[model samples]
Target chain A: MVSIAEHTPAPGRAGGGRLAWAFVERQTNLWKRYWAWELVWLMYGVVNTLAITFIAKQVGNEGAASSINVSKLILFLLIGTLVWAYLSAVLDDISLVVTWERWEGTIEHTLMAPVPRALHLIGMSVFGVLHAVVRTLLIFAIAVPFFSIDFGGANWLTAAVVLAAGSFSIAGLAILAGVLPLLYPERGAQMSFMVQALVLLVSGVYYQVSVLPGWLQVFSYVSPATYILDGIRGGIIDGKSVADTWRTLAALGVFGTVLIPLGIVTFMVAEQWAKKTGKLKRQG
Target chain B: MLDELPLRAAGVAKTFGGGFDYGRLLPWRRDGHAPEPPRRVVDDVSFEIRRREIFGVIGANGSGKSTLIRIISTLLLPDAGEVRIFGLDVVRDTMRVRALINRVSADPSFFRNMNALENLLFFGKVYGLSGRDVREQSPRVLARLGLDWEQALEPMSHLSRGQQQKVAVARALLTSPVLMLLDEPTTGLDPRSKRDVQSFVREVREEHDATILLTTHDMEEAELLCDRIAFLSGGRIVAEGTPVELRRTIAAGRPLDEITMETVFMELTGRSVEEDEEPREVLAHG
Candidate 1:
């Protein structure tokens, strides 16, 4: 056997990209183990989108449906539900970062390693984005034929760009919410879900933001999901080009630019405080 | 030389509980509103480890040995005082200090779903090891700790407690840390596995020139592996010296062979090693 001394890595920092990919790999391995749960969530999303979007068809078939365009309403509901699915998936994945560590009982070991905090978090965010994308695409594929929607005029490329652009801001917000579990292990997971619920209510996942009361509109302005939902609806349901949706794209870019750094700094502060308070160890 | 000391801790302290909480004032107090005092888990502890020395801290469960190790390893910040690794302050030079240190504690956590090879490879990457290096080297380290290479390919959750402990040991050694902190690394291992880990620790120091600070409750294991041992009671070091020196100090002219490390510990702490733990619930009738 080779002496451990001979194989010791030289003292230095791990590559940021390699460490990030390792975290992504870790999540992928976890997905492989619990794929049944993943499929269950996928099935639940498909059922949910179908159930909600069919409301439009029911309304159109009503006796007072003289002015209802069943196809347009179905498209509207489909885009709303699908966009909500994608947005919520990203939020849940990012916010559960700390919860996942605690459940696995690996919080102490992972935090004690020599890697920088930013690299660790960014890696997790990268995984969250990729995982959410794959899961959302699967749901979309399953719902497409079931809904019987025509793909004739929808600007698919533009919708994809909008979804991608909105993801960064969602990642930032999720990172911020992830700090709750680190700070208050007992109620932190619930608190993170509450934050997600707030984003959902204010982001117009099922209705237009203008329909919200004036005070609630402030939250919608702050939520990147509002812009995301609007941009996605315009691209897919209204068949708008990227040039037409550039305002929402730019708004998302601005939110990402601001929130990512803010989230990182805030999470770091909370993490340092947790360490001083001895909260890094898994609490019963 | 002190300049090259692998570990130095001065007046390190960590207290648990006693922070202000509204819940404590919720009429559950025991008569007359007396609040619970903060328990100092690591109380004004001070120590230094010279380069390549294997230092042992012997204590019963809950004697603060693990807390002291955590403070030195930069896992938890000390409430007061400071720790330095290779003369770099643990708090201010945390990243550099972390690069120099690695720790193996009791019940070392891993990605249980992944095989030992996968877990080690992830940690190896965290320690900056290349993929090829981790794949080639981790198996050899596992074999040295008496874990079969084939068995290491199974999920860590499937391994025995002792086998998992060996994997933990192997993980720490994979980084070739300049200062290795073993907080009860073999506490729950079987005898054979214990000996495997013990001999592995010895070989690591000899071959890698790694300095080790080991905390354990096993008296014979301490005497066998530690160049010097410190007996801790109630979060304080009651005695510290070479094993033989500690035995002879209180031997009172008795035969040296008759005075064992257990006796030395009993003499210093006023309790047997088995009874050294601080009882949690004090019996009281009010």
Candidate 2:
């Protein structure tokens, strides 16, 4: 017989961290197996980035008399597209947590494992952020050559801070959306996609939030992406320092602090409801 | 001292469905439709398993076999009563209970695109085993269960259902759970694969000193592998005893050898082992 002593897990926090990493490793392996799908997504991301960035070039050419600097406009749209891509990737990965489990018919097995739900979610969030970073970097690298963008005055530190904060806040929102599939399996995944669409519309991924109608602009105040885009644009376009974007940074900080724990709590509550309602069972 | 026991469930019950219908408030003048009433899927069930014993709950489909298993596995909450695993409340000490138990369901649930070794390593790590330990142990477990290492390297979707089931069994055993919940582990296996799993289950109990709670509609399987059997009908245990004792309950002095499990099941539940009950909405809200 294999000795239980030999296989017994390390107790407490250390073990919890390992359990969380297990999800990351599992996701990596799954993605490796689904390389073709990843390739398709990457191709689509590149095409989408190029398509949006080219619009600035078209407007710059068509209206040479206008104040819009062709190179700066292209850079502005590029930043927006790339940031949206990263945010969308993170959101997609995190929000599909339940959907992926259901698709693989492993929802029960994964949930019933010895790991705490919090750690499991944290692991998933970590993977989502990492996966998003890599995919966004690739899209940025491929799309950069197509535009005459300048970065000599770019405030890299401020942009990094904003990106990190925005990722955390978006993770929380994704977790909230993730429970949709757990709560409504038949239409839950589509509901999550719709949540992402709403975020895109309100957050001004492709345009200025100020351009939105006053009623719609109110939502931009609540969206982490609004601050993310504004701060990133300020950093990359005008080279604003961290001190100049303190308000945006503070807002993102508040969002991250509040939404992450809120997401975890909501997920736990939804999990209990799923258990009670038998919604945890695998469904088509 | 209660912690020394392998499993204990007391007056456990679960019901599904029956909530206010918001759809009824829709504006269209329509025939009023009431919400479906709650159905007791597992009604006041209680059972215990001793250390290293193979206890079976045999029932047809929708008899609450899977629900009882889910409750014990800590995947679902009981509406009433308590389940204690090694004296830890399943609800309160869920993490600790989960550590002591692992389950295999009818579906060999997995990331179908990933190879068996990858899946096992992932599950093993979730249960706190290191990758190196899983790598060292999983091959041995798989080989013992009659799965080749080459086969274990193929994507799960590429493997036969029986092979995939073997991988599932290996994943459960990989954790070295003190209590193994096999919820119809052999339901879809081919005959040879079924025998492979059955023998492996017996081997696990004998060698690992693991207490097993298995549910199945396979009468012969229950008779062959279970030290004691409980006949479940409509979310309740209709009868429970050793195979011979269950047979003798309705034998009426007939030679014990002449009584088969099918006959005992027919006598006890008033239905054939092959019969399925009215399908309950297991996934519906309560």
Candidate 3:
């Protein structure tokens, strides 16, 4: 006869922050438990970054570098790789919110909890940003040693500001992608990755957006990644201040303002649809 | 005003996959074919459980027991009718209602790689309890359910099925929900584990003053644990009362003690406890 009242804390006792931190704690614990998977992903990111950066090295060594600054080329490609790594990590973490729950068969339990859905999404987004930041930093640290890169004039504050603004918009897109798995359990996760691939194709992860076809360039206009990359490149390689990249920062701001709310609303609507169609119980 | 009743459902109904096919509007998917009609999973069901009572809804698999539980748990919306927990509408006041209820499904859904204590701590925090509270209270809850603390510290995947089920129960109790929805809680457990869970459920109600709505196919388990029982067949309650009263309905003037739940189930639902209903395909999109 345990006295429940004596043991159970009142609901919403500490406020939404503490409640939201629960997800962060849970995800961290999960990462710890699956350290092997984290190591594998980290290794893959490292190799991918190196392979792309080596193209500049190859071009420089092949006597095609008399006119081009090989160091700047390396830095350009390195920024692209590192930024994409960070952005994609955020995208992957948030988009897999539903996939992870379903895989563990805990979607029902999680949905039935007393917390507001907004808090839940925010919590996951926060974890995504934090997790991506740490991983991206590690990738940067590892890749920098291999290149004789100059960072004497880099405006890191501008890059950081651009990244912060860009992450919100990416989180919004990830939330939208997450709705796919809630609605179509069997193929939704794969569908989410396809969305990421589309973003990659349109956003010029490793090349200039201007180099893409005119019609594809129209998509680049709407992609937050396009602005994010341009802003970061201007800040790091060209050493431009935030004031110099106001237009790019403004574009990301608009995206964040529109997409975050849109994503949350779409996700809520999809959740209702899932409930109506009995999709929540389906694990696949 | 209805807060005194821990649980209540009125004319609750749910149908899956009966609507116009919006997917057909797609250019590549314009095949002219009628959509499948919606199938009623829980039809016009109604019941109530008083505070501190262990109420059971007994039916075979696919008889809508789980669907009903889902509705009450706020995991699903009823197509028609309403459910209230502690005077809160499950639909309109879902978050508030959720604060008062917790559910245990047949599958002990958990993070397999994480240990049980970690999982419990996560769930507890979601319900607004601090991690320190969960850590301090979990050992006692686990011990009360006959689970060793060492076993709970191991990853959930390494634990046996029964042990996993116990962890599920422990997770639910950690929230200290006033209304406990146990959807086939003892399903797939060994007999001894089943008894342990059943006794713990009883102890929960007595000590915690909780109202419990449990769904099960095990008639004997229902008889042993439920204060009152409802016979659910084809998404409706066919008969409901105390065990003796339910048996007496089909007793035909014979001694009530001579009646078995199996006989009552057979007379009322026209099927054995082990029989399963025909499966139906539920469309994910309508």
Candidate 4:
């Protein structure tokens, strides 16, 4: 017989808060607990930078077209690689938080909070991208001395715009990825794998979009990373002015409008499905 | 009688299905076959939890006690009936309803790698509590739950299950949430920790004007802490009343003071939670 006098410790808002600064504080605290993850990320960045430098050298030696300027190409490739990392980092965190809640049975807490579920995902992605941005900046600081590379045209304004647009797109995709974790939770790796596949093949990561055949080129157009990488490359490497990169921003903004609504709707529907299916109740 | 009920539910039903149907085609599914008829997890559960009263809910495993809590918390939408929290429709005014309540489950997952302060601070922020308020009130809640402030910075994993559970209580109290849905809060605690928590809950209600809905299978917990209890069996409330009223009703000839809820549960359901003595450990897995 359980006695009220003898009983002990006890614990939901499924995402209910608005996109509040206070909510972001909740996310920031979560990020702090996993410091070892940051060190691992630093190692990943170093290995990744080395891998791109090696690959760019190979492309130069093999006489691949698109101008085999070794130093510039390596730097450009590294920049492109870092951008991909930044975007995926945001998406990864968003999806993983959903997965984490499912695994730990903590989603109920978030669901019960007085915030929208989308705000939680958006808040998570924003912080994740902020972490990635800071990490990329650190990598640049380290690379500048070791690799003896220039920071390209010092137009902080264009860099800022590109970064802003890039983060917005990644934030959008992060919500999309976050939705998949809620929808197809059993298919754990599938959500992240698809996000990575979209980044690696469709975006100009290892290869440029123009290099692809026409059929594959269509996919590149749809990828947010393609516009993001192209804009970054134009502004930083090619030293192209704002007029030249307007198309990239316009494309990204359009993608943002479509994805933002679609992502939110999909998430709401997926959560509704979860409620309808009693998945949240069952799991919690 | 129910004019100002904090929570009210009537004929609330929930069904589960659409599982693995993409591969195995549902016959009536919009995309394919609907597969099989969905099994009802929560079936026609009707009850009202009045404001500022501690309502105890007792049920066997798989009897939908947790599901009922989730539906009340607005984490779930019932298929058939309505739920209103603080006179607001749960479905139509979900955002407001959420603000009025917070649930604490059996195995509450605080950030495992974080310290007690960190998890509480994080949750305080989630409820839109100011940093100043969290900074001021967090230690107070922890202290009220018998947590040691000097050891507040230790990683949660290092804390005993009881201590961690205390932290969970502190976190829920951050909002001073009016309606607290506690699901088997003391399931794994040592006896002393259990006593501390139960007493703390009484204090919360007596001092803060809070209404509580606690789910448990412990007969003593229902008798001692709950003002009224509803015996749940197979997703239905078999019986409900004040502690004394319930005992008298269950055993008509027996003196109320001599009656036990375990006896009531046995008489009504033809089964008892104590019979399942396999001791379900609240295992902590990532």
Residues B110-204, candidate 3, lDDT per residue (tens digit)? Answer: 99999999999999999988889899999999998889999989999999999999999999998888889999999899999999999999998
State the local distance difference test value for candidate 4.
0.74
Candidate 2 lDDT over residue span B1-286, tens digit each: 2366778889999988776666677866236666677788998888888878899999999899999999888888999999998898998888888888999888999999999999998898888888898899988999999989999899999999999999999999988788899999998889999999999999999988788999999988998899999999989899988998998899897999998899999998998878888635544543
How displaced is residue B259 in candidate 4, in Å? 2.9
- Summarize candidate 4's per-residue lDDT along A136-195 as a digit string, tens digits: 877666654545456656455665687787677777776777776676667754866687
Cα-based lDDT for every prediction: 0.84, 0.89, 0.89, 0.74
DockQ for the candidates, in order? 0.47, 0.56, 0.59, 0.35
What tier of docking accuracy does candidate 2 attain? Answer: medium
The positional error of residue A24 in candidate 3, measured at the CA in angstroms, is 0.6
Estimate the lDDT of model 2.
Answer: 0.89
iRMS of each prediction: 4.6, 3.5, 3.4, 8.3
| Candidate 1 whole-model C-alpha lDDT, 0 to 1 | 0.84
Instruction: Pick the DockQ winner.
Output: 3
**What is the DockQ score of candidate 4, to 2 decimals?**
0.35
Better of 1 and 4 by DockQ: 1
Residue B4 lDDT in model 1?
71
lDDT of 1 by residue, A57-144 (tens): 7887784454336777788788888887887788888888888988888887888777788888888888888988898888888887
Where does model 4 exceed 4 Å of error?
A1-19, A59-68, A144-156, A281-284, B1-3, B18-20, B26-37, B275-286
Candidate 1 clashes between residue pairs 3 or more apart in a chain or in different chains:
none
- Superposed model 1: Cα runs more than 4 Å off: A1-13, A63-68, B1-3, B22-36, B279-286
lDDT at B28 for candidate 1? 68
In Å, residue A133's CA in model 1 sits off its true spot by 0.6
Chain B vs. true chain B: TM-score per candidate: 0.91, 0.94, 0.94, 0.88
